[model samples]
Target chain A: MTDAPDRPADAETGTDLPAGPADSDAETDPRTDGGLPAMDGAVPTRDPGAFSQLATALGRPLVVGTVLVTVVFLILPVLATFAASFAHEWAGVLPTFVRDGEFLTLVNWRQALGLTQTDLGAQRGLGGFWTVFGVPIPVTIGFSMLLALGGVVINLLVGVPIAYAVTRYDFYGRGWLNTFAVLPVVPGIILGVAFLKTYSDLPSAVGLMIGYSLLKAPYMVLAVQSSFESMDLRQLEESARSLGASWPRTFLTVVVPNAKTGIVAGAIVCWTLAAAEFNFSYIVYSSGPKPFSLFLFENISNNPFLQAAAAISVYFAIVVVVTALLQAVGQRGFALGGVR
Target chain B: MSTLDEGPLVARLRTGTEALLSPTTETDRERRRIAALALPFVALAVFGAVVPLVVMFRISVAEEYLTATAGVQFDAWVTLLASILAFVPGVGSAVDADPVYGEVIWNSLWFGAVTTVASVALGIVIAHALEKYDLPGEGLLVTLISFPISLPGIVAAFMMIVWFGKTGLLTNVFVWLGGEASLFPAVTSNEVKLTGRPSGTTIAVFGLFLGYLYSMVPRATFLLRGAYAEVNTDAEAAARALGATPWQTFRYVTLPQIRPGIVGAVILTFRTALAIFGTVLVLKALSVVTFRFDQILKVGYDLPTASALAGLFFFFTVGFTFLSLRFTSAEVTG
Candidate 1:
């Protein structure tokens, strides 16, 4: 414990070894004379303990192996699924990317996106494109994106203010309110079951948007709360107030703008998640355009393996783009709220 | 004194409303501001969650099915409770009810528990390595690991099939290595009955377990990473300087600090595990409670029973999560 002060000096001398030979000589003299005695006294001179020896021999390998294996286990299939989406067949150990001597083909992609009709039926693909002004957008993906965007809009409206209230104020039931705001109240399946009889007359898209907002609100709240927690909200509010700005103006112009990064990142995460939400969408979806998750489910449950891969790869493409955007906004992917 | 006729509670409530509606004092103004900020969330919660859940409970006990819920019936609750009671070995014989509900609930609890422990354990290791060691491309590693967190449970099940299905990569590798195709675990082959072994159920359940882990491990890892970030490295270094081995340093110093985090991770991850429906829906390996809800709703259209089961599940999760958090020192950031 006492030698803690010498640790940084030792590291400094080690790094400074080749930079300046003359200066390093002076540094090394004290490090060797002083740090060496302390290290010698602290370190055991006898045979290494059994546990120490075992840890020294196998610790790094064990930990590194677990990380390596877990990474491979988690990522290999994502890559494989994405690759298989473009492949012609996957009869053997590996998916064969070549078809008719061509290295790769977009037949699966085209079929999966509902661009080509197949014997698999019209329900199999994304159900054709919804063209806007001469630009065609895949209907299912576009609709789901819009629905999830609706959810994001609701989340921002509902999450940001509550996050500010909980982080900035001290009031009765504040802790409980904060917990409720940041922790999901119910799972999607339950919510779907609840929605069945309660809002049976509501439009499927509207119900889904509301459900998505409620289901994914916790993420938005958590993200925004983290941003709020980092800032001294009271100070900021007071400063803005002292500058003759109204409370609403301070919150809208100062506080909300300051946490723009978190809001954007939260929106990206919530949008992607809501778009891919399956349990609620599956239960509540009776008629109308299929959400992206239901589309993936149809492909997975009924379509061919390659086409299913292609369908799932469509989502992978969305998540990859969202992840890149999140990184740009200073969050490490979905680390902020990975639940659900 | 003038409002004594209304009773103290009503008078207080009136005053509270008045203060909220029109506040002159600074304290009252702050209180009103807080209420204004909280109003939207409260409104959303009431309409979106509270109202629906209340209607669900009404449907759970409603006398009829899809039409207007006229009258009250305890039939669904009675049957559900009887089924749960029938799961007990001796009580089951006496109750004379199908143990399917009990079985599914048991499967969910055990599966959720097993997966929670496994994933949280694995998470600790992954988080330790990421925080302690200088692993190359750490940011990329985090991104890749967290990438799955965005993938829905159905996609996770698909990933499992890509690995363990009959035409899956690992299964084919084993087949190539001269193993009997019948003995291998594949999502496609459920009919291969091997001698002296129950291969089919085990294979499917194991695949589902892997699917659960695929979704769970990253969540647990990220949860613990938050805890790992706050560990005092100075104490760890001091312990190491005192001749403690790497394992000792971790076991004595690091583990104690992150134990609360581990607890929190276990709680949240277990909640995640229990709520898992899409993966089970896709795999169709084991009939857990969530999957049972699908069967009740889709196959038989048993709305009341489904509502009853869902209500029970929601209460259990909310109660368990809140009670555990209140009692323990678990800090949940996510």
Candidate 2:
């Protein structure tokens, strides 16, 4: 910033410079633009199609060695688990896992689908009980579905009012409101637990719904703000007041449609997280109704049953599949789109 | 008819609430309001999550918290040796008693660190590859990679149990393909077999990594994809126009740009792995209590000691998370 080029310019385009330092202190100075040097633009090149050279550097001893060691040391067990889901009767050899297959049986998938457990301490789950009437799939998966649905439903209600306040009017604590909403969503079991303790002894199911909304509402509000931010306020109110429409009607017709995608995508993220949840479910529902993940936990603890495992797998598979389908249909571009 | 259009009442009511919004108020009033709103939520979170931990910590340090077997005593720390001696008779009883706590914590931390480091690195590579496979089953592959996220940890654990366990498909397939002698679980004699134990912290960590990675990779890929878009393509072209190696251009340009994304994803994954309970409990069945809470409680609950430990655990978790999130968010947002 000491350089003439980086120093403040006329209030024209905000950043109208060609983006370089003044030519004076080139040799001794490190930073050319802000803290980053402008010489970063220049790189001496070698061959055409030299993209392979980057790949070659990736193969350097440090990179290759670290990657291999990580895979062997860290990822191998995960790989083992993924394969074990298809297993049955192999537990003796694979003592670490609940089920080990002596011979491949579709039984894990079957029992997971709500068939009777040959072993102890397992139950039917949401994936298995799927139908039009909606039979309750027992255990972790079912509980998760309920939590996810509850999160979405509650957020839709919570988000609309907050969105309206930010969008239609200049509201109180608008800046800090934005921060307070988002500040909770990051993973921390301690803070969340602390929040719930004040409202304890009620149903944990209620806690799950409320907690998820509290965490997700900020993200939803942030997303909704984008649509609210980009709006032209004059046309919206002028037309409404002129045509004898109320403030609510004008918002419903003009505002909501434009912001619909952001809200939907935000809601999806909120609910998906609820469905794919863990820590709270484990801690909150210590004696309450177990969710799909918790039920899955019971399966592993009681000794693995292929049917039970498969049932749980199918439930989640269905969720992911549905999400992907929705994502595909919703928007084609914008990688950071509200789909979250 | 026009009289029904009275907006005064509604406007007044709305204004009533909005009046509390202040440009200038006593500092204490604002602080009090903030605390009031925050305190309730904070209290709720504690009762639900921290109470059990509080109970654990109190007993660890106190006279007694649990109303179960044994007297109102606070000598559980000393008796930790006695339990170890009973469980596994001691070559060196008092010194390394309750080694499960040490072993499990080590296993958890090492596994978490390695997996996070690995995933961030591989996710970048795989994401780059997937951008244009121009091949078949791309959708399925992407979905499969993300399977662990939506899928629960227990389910993943069970899956690993079946697939990598001694009689699992891979092992069975290996044996079926006539590699039994070289394959795992070879039964030379009735008494001599090669099946491995399915319950251990190692596999549990493995299960955790899968679940964490499946959730993390998509986000990381998204971040990197954005990072990749931000790359000055013209600079690369200029570099190619000169005599720079691709490695040189990437080292000098691409990697520096993507550093923030990589760090953020790594932090997210590490936190997720550390706090995981489902996989560890299910896989090991809580037989191996890793940290101080589980270990001390397994020893009789000395109220004051347990409370101190719980406070430490709570503080440690909060401090670690807050610091990491601060660093990662700053790195990215800045």
Candidate 3:
């Protein structure tokens, strides 16, 4: 709730470490910026006239405004959906709102979460209501979650061996493997669709795994590789090898701990993507239990008030919650590299 | 065939093979095995990206267009492959069927243009502001602002619809202002016409833009801000002291240095826009026949048109990607 002295701005409680002068020197050096000191440390001073001091104090608004705008862009629509769900009825023109004061109710939840959809005639002008995924929440969300989680687990398992191989020793295809792993995002779905089309006859879930793995595996490989890159592997291997420790014992006792942060980050990324997934899930399974995005898409109705269908707002809410939870976990673990 | 060449060469080759098979240490053995295993992953990447994209490009050229009959037709595919020079008119006819296709393109481009400029502008401003305005929550603000990275583009669209729709709270605020139909258009019913037009394409495009802005701005901010952060103040002060306006300083000094990031941002924005059918379609129920919206969704929803559109987009994407890479490399290393 803190506001800069003379400005109106939203409340903020940020956590990145402050920009320091030493970081500035590397840039502001003559070689980089023509010998000028980095102006990152420069502060804007107010005029010598009245309110000079007051103007200087309003720094929070200037800086926090950008964050607020971003939040307002992101969170407000979702909060509104939560509001729409509660209000018993919606009727409006422009700023029009629900006539009934009820702004919170489990009816939206009850209807949406239940496995069966009710055809409430005009009120629920939708197709048949038998749940597609065995639940109102849609089996797709569950499946996608499982898929992404599966992806995280699988990639971490696969990527670690891959990383260790590259870091500890040399191989013929090592450079090519590394390059393949870090290649930037191309149209991954084109590849996803190709694999899906070729393997459509198979159990779709397996097809999905293969399709998503095409993208996720590489991400994991790169993340793990970078972590390995910075690692002081000699310390771990030497420590174990010097102590008459077997290769397995040395890897277990030393190497694993050093790579924990990167692995955890990659896992978080994999899981979040799996849960939040769309395209690969879409192209792979068509309309079945695969993509969490289907649940999110249910609410984008011509009837805007029926936001349960276009639950993307809900998607954002879940994202915020997940992030908060991860932060809590990272803080608790004193995480060296928390998921970004 | 002769039993084989009998010479010292055979003996030398056998020794080499033996050396390769026999490792001196456990780690070396493990490393050899891993290298062997890694071949699959490389094969998978090649199979996944390189092969499919090549196939898609080839398929795009096949004139035997996939219709409702096949979703991938043969004649169109052949036509595409044969003429080599004929892809332009072929795709052009496909896209021009929609009246809004051009408008949608303009709108999408405009959307990309506006959002790109806005995000880039905001990114640079925030980067500079973070330095000048070292407020209490500054660090947190930067981190929070940069966090929309993981929020999917589609999710952002829904949030925006709820936030900006006629029944949305903001729209509700406008309603409170005496049912201002001009400022706030009707969102609830298809019965209600918007700004004299009911098509949700432009509205949908706006929604997509906002979503993309959220996702891309943070990326832009992160990359450009990092670039700016590395810049020395003395250089900025020098520019400022040399009679440069604040705008001029940013343009002359800051802009060129961060050009690579800006180019990356453009490629990123263009890439997403090219593939943005999902968000646009979901938001507007975008149609090809009516063709009034930024056709962003319509771009890919229709099979033949989308196939053609996708091919066109792939060309642009590859070209832009290559161009950006070339330019960025030239700038950085030059």
Best by lDDT: 1
| DockQ, all candidates in order | 0.43, 0.14, 0.21
* CAPRI rating of model 1: acceptable
| Best first by DockQ, ranked | 1, 3, 2
Scored by TM against the true chain B, the candidates give 0.93, 0.59, 0.62
lDDT for each residue of candidate 3 in B1-334, tens digit (9 for 90 to 100): 3437657787777765565488676655665566554655656556555665665555444444343122344554343333333324456545323233344444555565677777766766665676545556765565465455565555655555555555555555655643445444544343221211244556554544565565666655654554555566787788666544454455556666666655655555555544554454445533321122124223553333434444544565567656676666422110
Identify the superior model by DockQ, candidate 2 or candidate 3: 3
TM-score of chain B of 3: 0.62
lDDT of 1 by residue, B37-130 (tens): 9999999999999999999999899998677888899888999999999998777989978888999999999999999999999999999999
Best-performing candidate as measured by DockQ = 1
TM-score of chain A of 2: 0.62
CA error at residue A9 for candidate 2, angstroms: 44
lDDT values for all models = 0.85, 0.50, 0.52
Docking class of 2: incorrect
In model 1, the number of clashes is 0
Candidate 2 C-alpha lDDT tens digits along A1-340: 1111222334543432333454434733676566855354543322223244335445344444443443343334444444445765444445234424345555666565555655233442333343446664455556677787887776666665565554555435664444434444334343233333333567777777666666556556555665566777557766776898765566678667767776776666567666656555654454466655555555556544544445555655566556674466462222232112
Query: What is the RMSD of candidate 1?
Result: 8.8
Better of 2 and 3 by lDDT: 3
